[model samples]
Target: MSRLALPTVIALALALSACATSNPDVIGRHEAQRMSQVLDATVLSSRPVVVEGNQSGVGAVAGGVVGAISGGSVGGRREGQVAGVLGAVAGAVIGNAIERSTTRESAVEILLQLRNGERRSVVQAQGSEQFAPGEAVILVTTGGKTRVMRAPPVTAAPPAPAASH
Candidate 1:
């Protein structure tokens, strides 16, 4: 394989690893993961969340490598080496900026009052329902993290049939 600069190599690695955050144990799209606590809570309030962008440096390193490889492909050997170095530096900067901007996510912060009379706040990804104050919701907690969602409705069972004469 052709030689790659450190930055270029790093950038490529980051790009390939973008999907590492996906959960492998997910059984279904809408199902919640088993939690330590599942309780009904009242939504005291909710606020929009602006998640910070990633600063993993993966972009810079990966970009640098790609830039270097393409740069080295041009001109003579000595000139190609110089171009590769320049390309790597440029790639790193571009990659980092692109990653920071693209990786940002919108979320929500919910303040809940549990049935146990304890109050707490949770930050979770935004779902179908936009939370509102005074709403009844369910709290699911696991590993110190919590998610607030609207509670499923209770249904009454049908009465038994009468005996025939």
Candidate 2:
């Protein structure tokens, strides 16, 4: 690989890995310090699922650039131009596939029943927490996005002290 190609490939890799995630454990910087709505619910069902991948075009662009550069070094000027175009087209397709595969995530589909008798279904990327049917969990919503997590154990409140006479 050429001097410029190695760094470009590394940068492309880093960019691909930085794709956004819907994991319940991950909170965006913008969501920090924001108030969220919480609802108590019980898992009616939990099943494994796959989250579809994203196609943001970053991979295609990066791949095209790399391909052009690599192909431009071949043969004479006319041959190099033709090869560069062909390489770019091929690279773009490959890159798109790579992006899709890498961005795909293992997720779960959870059916929940709220205390008010309302039912809701949510799909989220798998994280440190796992859910099972009949498990207590909380649905936290912030900025229109919601995540499900295991609810904390309930504890009794301390008794109030008697007023002095």
Give all TM-scores, in the order shown: 0.70, 0.89
Give lDDT for model 2: 0.86
Candidate 2 lDDT over residue span 1-165, tens digit each? 645884676477557656589999899998999999999999999999998887888777767777777777889999999998987887777777777778889999999999999999999999999898999999999999999999999999999998999
44-74: candidate 1 lDDT, tens digit per residue = 9899877766878878777777778878887
- Give the residue spans of candidate 2 off by over 4 A: 1-3, 158-165
Compute the lDDT of residue 92 as modeled in candidate 1: 83
